[model samples]
Structure formats: C-alpha cells, structure tokens
Target: MSDLSGIWVAIVTPFHNDATHSVDHAALRRLVQHLRQAEVTGLVALGSTGEAAALDDAEQDAVLDTVLDAAQGLPVIGGLAGNHVGHLHARLAHLNTLPLHAVLSPAPYYVRPSQAALVHHFQDLAERSHAPLVLYDIPYRTGVAMDLHTILTLAEHPHITGIKDCGGSLDKTQQLIADGRLQVLAGEDAQIFHNLCLGGAGAITAAAQTCPEGFMKMYGALREGQLKEARQWQHLLSPLIRALYAEPNPSVVKAVLANQGLVTTISRAPHLAASEEARRAATQVLDRVLREARHIGPESNR
Candidate 1:
C-alpha cells in the first residue's frame, strides 16, 4: 500500500503570463523540484487546487506528465472527479498506464447519488483502477456528502486505501481515524494539525505549497512528539493559510507563487486573477511566516 501519511501538497498548475496563458511546464517542474527540496511527503497532481476542471483532457494529461517526470520518485496522487461512469473508467484506464501512487476521487458531483449508490460507484471504480483509490469527501463542492457509514462501507473494499476528509464533521473525522481501515488525510488545511492530533495519517493540503518548509517543520515536530513546537508552527502558518483562501483557491496561491517568481498569477478562464488586495495580504502573511520559520531552526529551511 502507498504510505498516505505525512504532508502531501496539492500542487497548483502553473500558467504562462502570455495571452494564450498556456501551461508553464518549466515553471511547474521548477515548483515540483522546490517542493521536493522542502521535503513534502508527496504530490497530488490535477487536484482542485490545480484547476483541473478548466483544462481539457489533453491539457490535463500533459500536466500530469510534467508532474510525474518532475516528481522523480516522490509518490504522486492524481485527482479524478466527475459523474460520468464511462468517462471516469476510461480516465482510470489511462491513469493506470502511469506510475501514480493512488487516484483521489470524490462522490459523483451534482448527481447526489444515494449513499448506497455512492458505495457502488467507488467500489466499481476501485475494482477497475490499477492504482489504489483515495476517496475525496469534499461535500460542499461535490454537492453531496458521504456519511461515516458509507465511507466505512467503501473502506471495506481492498483497493480503497485512504480518504481526503472535508466532510466538516468532527465526529465523522474522529470515527474514521478510530475505525482504522483507511488512511485518513485531512483535506481542509485548517484541520491538518487537529486531524494529526486525532491520529489521522496527515494532510493533502493546498496551503502547504506556499510555505512547504514551514509545513514540513510542523509535520516533523508533530511526528517527533513536539506538540508545543508543532503548535507554534501552526500559529505562524494559520494567517497565511487564511490569506491563501481569501480569494478563490489557486488565484491567491498563484499570486503568492508569482510574487516569488515561481509562476504567473493567472488562473484559467472562469477563474479570475487574485485582486491586488488579496495578493498583498497573502504575500505579507507568507513573508511573516517565512521570517518566523527561520527562527525555528534549519529544519524549516529548504
């Protein structure tokens, strides 16, 4: 089984600043190398943070290829979501051709399938997928929530190895951790520390991409039973995390990355660029977090 524990960054897709706003493979590779240097446990490509919905299939495949090549040996998880069963299966078949550690999928969005149907959907997918499956339970975006029982049922499937918990229920989160069938990764950035404290595997967080060294330090301190140190890192990182989400996801995240010259601040069409105010706020918070991270010692340095 893939080790789904520790900090896995849901990396953003970098775009060129030109009119076409093409996928910046060079910048994306550089970002991957940077994250690898920061010691993130792994990478989740084509996740929501990656603006996967905006990219065509060819674009998505190209982006995944870039990520896979640049990831070196880091275990990379690819995101898959949609209501179309045939298309999903086809995508899974294509993904099976890659060396992904796992494929992260969610409940069929907008369809709001019955819990039993949800179970069937995942089970079917798991059976067809060569790679292990990590369930993505972000109800708000998916328009449907998977109950604890539903998740437990899916966990019984051998190929369903983990879950990205964004169900927004502390009870559900705790129970999943207690059940111990599937590795539980906190999908919500603010819940990473709390989830870890509750015996969760770790987090699949977009925020980690911004200040990965600080996140690595936080995870490292927690792993070594340094709760107090972990708490300090959490406090330092909270503001920046909030700021990154102050605008729609990857926009502010890209803004911050652009500020560091890693990528352009452009998001795909239908998603606006981060406002100057949001960019300034995120950059300010990021700067402060980096400054404080320096004091936490060399472990926080990339």
Candidate 2:
C-alpha cells in the first residue's frame, strides 16, 4: 500500500445555497483545487467533518464522486461509519469498485459493542474490503472505545493497516507508536502537534481545512525534526482550532470558509451557523496563520 503519511484534510461538503441546500459539485471541485494547492497528502470525503451523517447514501456517493474527480491524482479516503456489520460489509463490497486509497472506519457507534465484538466487526469489514482500512477510535462520538488489546489484536490483520487515534488516551497512543505495527494518525486537530512530536505518522485534521498551508508546513517541520519551527506554527494555529470547534464542527468551519469566499456558510439542520464572534475569531487567526505558513516550505527543499 502507499504510505499513509503526511497531512490529509477532512473536507466539508459544500451546499448550493441555504434554500435548496443541495450538494454543490462546482463549489466542492473548487474547494478541492484550493487544498491541492496547499499540497495536502490526501483528501477524506464523507468523514465527520464532511457531515456524512447528514447525507443519504445517494448524496454521499455523488459527493464522493465529485471529490475523486477534483482530487486529480491525490489519494482520497472515504469514511465508513456504519453500525451494522452486514450493511458495512456490503458497503465495503460496493466501495471496492471505486478507486479509493482507503476507508476510515470507526468502531460501531451508540451500540457500544464489546471488545471481542469490535474485533469481529472490524475483521469482517476488512475481509470484505478490497482497500486498506484506517481504524478510527473516537470514543467521545462513537460511544465505544477500542481497548488497547482490541486495537493490537486488530493490527494483526493485513488490511487493517493504520488508525486515526482520537481515543484520547495518552498510554494507548504511546503504546501504538512503540508497537510500530500500524500507522498512527492523529484524529483530533488539537493533538496533531503533540502526536507528531511523539512520532505519529500524520493527521486527518479538520482544522487543516482552514489553514492547510500552515498545517502542511507544521507536518514538514516535524518530519524533519525542526521542533522549534513546528512549535511556533502549532502555537499560532491553536487559536483557530479552538474557535473552529467553538461551534459544532463545520459550523465555524463553513463560516470561515465562506468568509474567505471558498464556499457558502450553509450547513444542514442540527448544526447551526457559527456565531459571529466565532467567525471573527477564526478569520482573524486564519489571517495570521496564512501569512506565516507561506514561509514553511518542504524542509528537504529548504
């Protein structure tokens, strides 16, 4: 498989307008171009940040197609957040037909299956998946955490190649790094810097959508052991990350993107638009981050 290292953005789905709220393929293509310019390693479609939950299967497929087309040659990872093993197996069967780099699958949410059941669930999906899998361990949203033992056990599968580590347990993160069996990518935006310093492979960060250049620069610096430069960039980016999540997910994110005229600030129901204060804060922080990120080029080139 190709190395799943470096930065990947959890792309937000763009809507046509608040009235119809239909998927805006044109805007999505433009957004993809914007991130590609930042030189992100990959793009993730239908993830949490992409509002996967809000989209129906057909809508999701259309969104994925648009992204795949816009991504040019960049690998695009599709999100799989199903609770039913049978359904997911079937879903993976269908996804296998597409040319995706990998699928990001989280533990079945709300159901909170046992550790043993978790193993069975993932194994079943991996068996059905033609592509490699990136295990997602976000307990806060998923309602179930994969124990270290369970994760280690899953790592034995050839197809279960990596993890998006949002389990929020320091010990688990460290142990995974020490094992060196699976590629560990930081799932949370705030932890990206700390995870990298501890030898994480990369991050599937939502905050990167706002300041892709800065995030890429930080990753480049960390990979090259440029701790001081990476630290400075992370510190500057911390505020924007905080503000982006100040509201639920893409709320503040869409607001910031809209402010920059990248996409509309229209989000589906259950997720309101970001507060004016949050938008102002994110925009202000973005301004500063973009200015600094321009200077953080590839360390090897530097």
Candidate 3:
C-alpha cells in the first residue's frame, strides 16, 4: 500500500467573524504552515474535525485549495462523507482534479446499509476515485460498523489502500493488522500509543494538531524501539487528549489552537465554542507539553 504511517493531522476549518461566517482562508493557510513547521506526516482537510459537514461546496473547495497551497508538498488527503452515491461519485471526480494524495471516506451515516451493500459502496468509490481510499470506520458517528469480514473483503481491492480505524474494537483492529492488507491508522487519539505499539501504522488524529511535535516524538520513540521514552510521552499526552474531547472535538481543539494564536476559538453553529473551564484544562495540558518539548528537544524522529 501507500505507507500511510506516521502522524497525519485532521486540520480544523477556521471561520471568519463576518455575518456570512465564511471560511478564514488566511488562518487556514497559517495553520497549514504551522503544521508543516511541526513536521506532520500529512494533512487531512475537511475531515470531521475540520467541520466538513458545516461547509458548503464552495467553502470546502476554497479550504482545500488553501491547504494544498500552504502544505508545500505534504500529502494532503480530502475527507469525503455522505450517503448519496451519485453525488459522492461526482465529488470524487471533483477531487480527482485536485492534487490530493487520497480521500478519507466513511460509511453512509444513518442509512446503515448492509455489509454487502457497504462493500459495493466503497468498491464504487475506490473505482471512481483517482486518489487512494482510506476507509473511515467510526461506528459511533456513522451508525454502522464494517465487520472484520467486510473490511478484509474490501482490503482486497488495490485502490482501497488503508483505513482510519475508529471502530474502538481492539479485536477488529488486531485482525486487520494480522491480515497484513490495509495500513491501519489509529483514528482515536487516546489509542494512538496502543495502536502504534501493536504494530499498527500511525494516526489520523485531531489531537495531534495541538502538539504535533509531541506526537511525532512519541511515534519516533516507538519506531526506534525506545519503549520507555514512548510511554513517557504518552503519559504526558494522555491528559491533553482527554481534555480535547471533553466537549465534542474541534471545539476544544480550536480553543487550544486559539490560545497559541494559530487559529481563532470560533466554531460553527450546533457546535458551540468550548467553555472556559474546558479550554483552561486543555491549555494547562498544552503548557506542559510545550515545556517538555523545550526541555527534551523538538527533534522528532531523532
């Protein structure tokens, strides 16, 4: 497959304060530059954490364009979701025109199609998408799970190269790893250490956006077989990871980013800005992470 290992960030979509609440292209560009400086493996634009659901087509296109431009050669993956096959096919075609590395698509939400049908859904996507496909298996969000059999069957396809595994089932994760077909990326921040330790690939994590250097350091320690160092980093990261999810996802993530002036604390409707308490807790953890980064050195992969 495409070696989808290492820490890939699920970038947040920054919005402006105008009446239209349009996307803040400038901030988005700045965030991209920030991540690039942090040495993240890749970028996933318009993913769930990026508020893809709230953005219109034009805004999403603009956001993708900004990220692509600012990435400066980082492999940027576009997040594709929805139940409409025809529209999705059209969307995939649209994505083909861009220079994306891949598309991270999840199962049809709420519809909960059968396994056989699910197989055909991704099969069609894989066939239509010029870029590689990374199946997003977040059962809680999608309301459906691709059982081990279904995942293995899909893994047989050449275009279906990897998976963003948020199923939260260790057994299923282990099975996919043992099968040796799809490159398994841990989608859950809390499970990143465990996943990497289990011979799984890297992560497509929202939490990594806050402290990309720290996550990369943890990954490097694991790859170098420095279990003790890896554990220490994970221990320090656990609180931040937990705090970021204390209120939904990117809300806390945005708040933390805003503290560093990387992005605003604004979030879209239905997802309120993180409360002061949550932001404070996350900021506290972020401070600790920064302190460690300074003391231990920021040389990830060393």
Q: Which model is ahead, 2 or 3, in terms of TM-score?
A: 3
Please identify model 1 stretches exceeding 4 Å from their true place. 297-302
Q: What are the per-residue Cα lDDT tens digits for candidate 1 across 171-209?
A: 999999999999999999999999999999999999898
Query: Backbone collision count in every prediction?
Result: 0, 0, 0
Looking at candidate 2, what is the lDDT of residue 72? 92
TM-score for each model:
0.97, 0.95, 0.97
lDDT per model, in order? 0.92, 0.89, 0.91
Of the two candidates 1 and 2, the one with more favorable TM-score, higher being better, is 1
Ranking by lDDT: 1, 3, 2
Task: Tell me the tens digit of each residue's lDDT in model 2 across 41-108.
Answer: 99999999999888988898899889999999899999999787777777777789899999999988
Candidate 3 lDDT tens digits, 32-67 = 999999999999999999999998888888899999
| Weakest lDDT window of 10 consecutive positions for candidate 1 | 293-302
lDDT of 1: 0.92
Ranking of models by TM-score: 1, 3, 2
